[model samples]
Target chain A: MVISRILQKTGFYFLIILVLLFTLFPFVQMLSTSLKHQYDWGNPSLIPQKLNWSSYSELLGFQKKEVKVPESIHRLLNNPKLSAEKRQKILDRFTSTSDVFPFINYFINTLLIAGTAAAISLLFAVFGAYSFSRVRYRGRSGIQRGVLLTYMFGGVLLMVPLYQISVQVGLANTSTGSILTLVVIYVVQTLPVSLYMLGNYFRSIPESLEEAAQIDGCSRFKTIFLIIVPLSLPMLVTVYIYAFMIAWNEYLFASVFLKNFNEFYTLPIGLKSLFVSKNAIWDRIMAASILTALPVVFVFMTFEKHLIGGLTEGGVKE
Target chain B: MVSHPGSLAQQEARFGWKTVAPSLLLIALLIVYPVAYNLYLSFFEVKLSGQNEFVGFNNYIDLLADRAFYDSLTVTVIYVVGSTLGTTLLGLGVASLMNHKFPLRGLVRGLVLLPYIAPLISEVFAWQFIFDPVNGIYNHMTVEVLGISDERVNLIGTPGNALLVVIIFDIWKNFPFAYLMILSRLQSINNDLYEAATLDGANRWQRFWNITLPELRFVVGAIVMLRFIWNINKFDEVFLLAPNVKTLPIYTYFTAFTGTIEQGLAAAIAVVQFLLLIGLIFLYIRRVLKW
Candidate 1:
């Protein structure tokens, strides 16, 4: 009996380790490859012979190499008429980041777009959820059902028609116009979940608190801001994180609307293009992948409990 | 009666509409309008110069006969089934394992969710590298380490193999969601039932089969259906990893954007997919998600 129990305990731990390895090995490979030199990959070892930070530095613009000056521009830099200061300015202007994948610029673009869309969706969801949960209204349940119905359809089914809308409105023609169109699409994609989450959260807040405030002459809008919003702050953060992750990871509509506008490519688009580009450097690509995933991972790990609670709460009741 | 502004209840109802109008308008314009518009566009021959020539049902007829469409449909069915079943079962296994008391349980629980929460692009590339023919560990393991095969297999380079790989990728990336849902449900199952089963002289497997499986049936069903809906219309997960996988969404994408630019045919495909999804959603909402 003692031997059987010991054997069972060992078997359980063995399975646990196997599960952990399967769950985490790809990440280990990514980090290992990113830190490896070119020749380092020829070996079978998981760790690099030497830890190289060059790819990280290059991608982050901290390498101090500035940019690769094109070979054709060599003559221009050496022209005697150019003063040292003038030549330096010309070099700075002519330095090309297109080949390097412009990680920082794409990072900023993704952060701004994802942040703006999440904030906007959260803001709209708060008001809409309050109305659904608190106020008496006509067609209220019907509208609620309609919104939920909207959540059922697939995004691909909406792509062609939404594409036509953007084109017809001429938003497909310009960079700024395309960015705006992408934002609108993201807002639509994220709003349903935000509404569902915030609406559920709003329903759970006790009516007595709001009623007491109303008796003290608080208006409906004022009570929402003062009582409900403050009370649901954790859930609001949860909703924002959910909405933000959707926009942040989206690639389909981003590809459709923003393909012509390379300058505005989000991280997913930029990263894919980098892989398909002529010089696909594994180290740099892996480094970029790690860099791209870092922020969201950090955010989620920090708010894991809150986010999971909010997600499972909605999920369980449904 | 509620439309009257004179009564306080009516006034309150009016305020509710006022507050909810922006969101309602947004959903109406974006989701509802586009769905109807897509159906309308399916009947036309859409041209590059923004001209539409109405050719009612011709796109659908052509789609019905398209060889690529048939191939894609087969691949999509396989992909969805493989992924949904894989994730659900893997999720059930992992969730059950984690339910047992273990050392560093909290940290292990958090780490298990990494695959689900990581950026899709990052994970896609990681899988690609893992299966890369020249340098990947897959070839190294099979050919050199195990000596099972003498050849370095280029799995992603072949469409059939690529579809399998894509299915595996979807399973790996998405199982945590299933895990999360199932784990939550598993935690809520009453322990007293299990204790009663144990006292009644039942073995672990027998007790689990009787109690745990029954408890998990509804949640597992919901997860499978939800995963089906997701994988059916999935775009980037398949596309980014293996562009040649040729799932329905990628097919629609290629038809609409690349090659011949058959926007009308793509719309036709979308309409069919939309109808299928509505059926699944109703079935899911009415049957599986009733809990």
Candidate 2:
């Protein structure tokens, strides 16, 4: 009986190890593909025989001439005192900068859009979640329902009208408009999950401590910032990281909304472009894909503890 | 913590809106406005670079008549159903395995979440390469190991297998989410009930069915409804993996933005997606809110 039990347990663990390989094998393959030299797509090996950084270097614009913008633009104000020739020279320098990968602009645009949207949405969601957790209100139940139900309004449904509105508002071909629009979408979509996690954490904190703070003549808001925020910092970071990851990885909205603006393509869009580009180097594309996913990967690994708490406690209720 | 109940109620009400005001305002402007506008657009004969005219239900009629629309509807249904079933069953299996007090269970559980956290584009692309006709690892393994020699089996290129492969890919990527939920819920179950069941000569299957199943019904119901709704409106997985298959969301995209640029028809399709999503959410609310 003991030997049979041990065999079964060993088999279970062996199966688990296989599952881990299943989960992580693709990433390993992608990394291997990325590290292969430019002309090695035909080799068809899991392990790269030779490592090359050329694809990555090309992506970061290492092969491009540097743009020397006038020191005036770097200054607080524009210097109109500069000659037209000097201004033209600066413009010329900017235009003359030639990137090798041809998608460096898309990279920066993605970062700006994802980074800004994540940052802003996190700021709003954290405060909103805190208030819902700590405060009492007549319509709190209704508001929470409303917030949760809003996610049912999938972005695909809004694509057409959003396009028209963007065109009308002169934001049709801009990255800022897409990012702001996405931030709004993500904030509402993610708010319910964030609130649920935070509310759980907040409830876990003893009310006696808050009462003590109240007795000390602290305002409710002040007490919250001073007490609860400090205690819940890990979860707060977890929520922010989750929100950021979602924003970064989002593609459907980014694909439809930012089609006309090549310069405004986010990492997801950039990766898709790699597939469809004229000079679609498979190795380089894989390299770019690796780069795009690195941020989210890092976030997940670093915050696994808080993420598990947030998720298992009902963040991913779906 | 405030003393006055009467004035404090009003103050709390004000604070509630104050805290939620920015998000509400943003939702109203972006979500509410666009939804309303889309509804309006669906009713009109709108076109790109042309004046809009009121054509009540014509767009809907045209879409309903279009053969591709029906195909897309069917595709969307199959995709959702297949993926949901796959994920749910796989999740159940994994959760049961984790329910046992095994060594290294914590590490294995954490590692299983890798699929859930990976970026969709990268992972989906990886799947694409795995199923690629010439050099895909899947084909190589099958042909070499399984002794099946079909000449260059294009899993994604053929229509029937294409959708099936997409469903497999979706399930592979998403089962971890459901597993996490079930495992957590399993951990919270009281062992006393199981102990009683065991004392009553209840075998493993009997205990699972009688006690475990009953205890997990609520979570399972909620997960089912939520997963159904989510998978139904899903765009990214299907759209990216099998763009040619024309799921509802992908079809809508092509109609409106990419291919034909049929703005009115696309708006109509979008409305259909919205109504379906809302109906699912309402169904989910009725099930979950009972608790």
lDDT of all predictions, in order shown? 0.87, 0.77
Number of the top TM-score candidate: 1
Writing each residue's lDDT as its tens digit, candidate 2 over A152-220 gives 666677778877887777766566776666656666656666766776788778888888998999877
Pairs that clash in candidate 2: none
Q: Give each prediction's DockQ, rounded to 2 decimals.
A: 0.67, 0.52
**Positional deviation of residue B58's Cα in model 1 after best superposition, in angstroms:** 0.3
State how far residue A167 of model 2 sits from its true place (Å): 1.8
lDDT over C-alpha atoms for residue A3 of model 2: 100
Tens-digit lDDT track for model 1 on A50-130?
A: 999998999898885556677767888788888999888777676744466689999999999999998998899999998
| CAPRI quality band, candidate 1 | medium
Residue B76's lDDT within candidate 1 is: 85
- The weakest ten consecutive residues by lDDT in model 1 chain A span A309-318
RMSD of each: 3.2, 7.0
